[model samples]
Target: MDFSGKKVLITGASRGIGKATAMAFAEKGAQVGLNYRNNIDEAKRTLKEMPGKGHQLFQKDIGKTENCKELIQEFIETYGRLDILVNNAGIFQHHKIDEIDFEEWTQTWETTFRTNLYAAAHLSYWASQKMMKSGGGRIVNVSSRGAFRGEPNAPAYGASKAALNAMSQSLAKKLAPHNIFVGVVAPGFTETEMGANALTPEERERLLAETSFKRMAKPEEVAHAILFLASEGAEYCSGAIIDVNGASYLRS
Candidate 1:
């Protein structure tokens, strides 16, 4: 599990699960590229907290195609090669069916898809090409339990995560021949900055009750699963989606 010379890039890495994942890699000796959109201060805080040196910060609005390409290119140029790509950047907006107007609903869908799914697709495309040239690499996608269980108020978010799972599987199969491994970690509600901002006291209580553990996952918990999927021995598990949902939702 040692990544002494590994170069990893994590998008949406300024805080929450992304930050935790970046730290996990850095602690294992990987040189990490932390990507954030608007939270420069928070991203800088994360950079300062990293365990190892040579970890760099990258600011990019991955929602745009050009930005996504640039983020990957910059990371490659800085580190020379990419060993892992973690697509953890995402946006969630509640565009309930009956409550929102058509325009609002459309906007939600467009923005959510661009940030959640399209960004991952574009980044993965460019990262995979670079990986192929350097022998091989790993791509670990951060999905959600909502992809399977559902997100009633945020239908677009649910749909995008589902699409991300499918995309990971597609790439896993396509990239296997080139020695690239792809896997997914689908986590339930984790106790992260985003979750803290989104959930109310009552909502948090209800979510806790719904889970078997009577609690939400910690960011570190999800990060451990992500690191495992990105490990060398996990090559045979390419295309696998490991659920880190604390038994909140089980799929047969």
Candidate 2:
């Protein structure tokens, strides 16, 4: 797990799991490039809290296709090489088929996919290209348990994450020859600002009851899985999906 001299780029790193992962990598001696959108204050706080030097922030809306390219370019220019890329930026919007209007439904699907799936695909392509030239690299994607079970309220969110999982596996197979490894971490409801904001007291209670631990996963817990997958000895684990859901949901 010693990432000394490694360079990593993480998206949605202003807070929650992304922030935790960035800090973990920093502590392990990796120079980090943190990406956040529309949250300069939180991003700055995360940057200041990092334990090491040579870390920088890139404020870009990764939901936009162009920004993904720009962000990777900026990180490469700043860090000289890329060792790991964590595609954690995502959106979860309620777009129940029976509840929302056609326009809103379409828009939600578009926005959700753009942010959750497309951005990750584009970044992986660009990052893996760099990794190919540099000998090897890792890409750890953040998915969701919703991808396996279901998201009655946010179908688009579930679909995007499921698609992300598929894409990661495809890349894992295609990129392995080039020394680029791909893995996924699918977490259930976690204790994060985003997750908290999306649930009511009753809803939170119900979700917690679904887990064996009777509680949500912590951001740091999810980050630990990401780090393990990104670590050097885990090259053989490429294309694997590790669940950090506290046994909230399971699939055969």
Over the stretch 18-75, how does candidate 2's per-residue lDDT look in tens digits?
Answer: 9999999999999999999999999999999999899999999998889988898999
After TM-score superposition, the amount by which residue 181's alpha carbon in candidate 1 deviates from its true location, in angstroms, is: 0.7
Per-candidate RMSD vs. true structure?
0.8, 0.7
Off by over 4 Å in 2: none
Cα lDDT listed for each candidate: 0.93, 0.94
Give lDDT: candidate 2, residue 112: 97
Clashing pairs in 1: none
**True-vs-predicted CA distance for residue 81, candidate 2, Å:** 0.5
TM-score of each: 0.98, 0.99
Model 1's number of clashes is 0
lDDT of 1 by residue, 1-252 (tens): 888999999999989999999999999999999999999999999999999799999999999899988898899899999999999998877788999999999999999999999999999999999999999999999999999989998999999999999999999999999999999999999998788776779988988998889889999999999999999898999999999988888899
Task: Give, for candidate 2, the lowest lDDT window spanning 10 residues.
Answer: 91-100
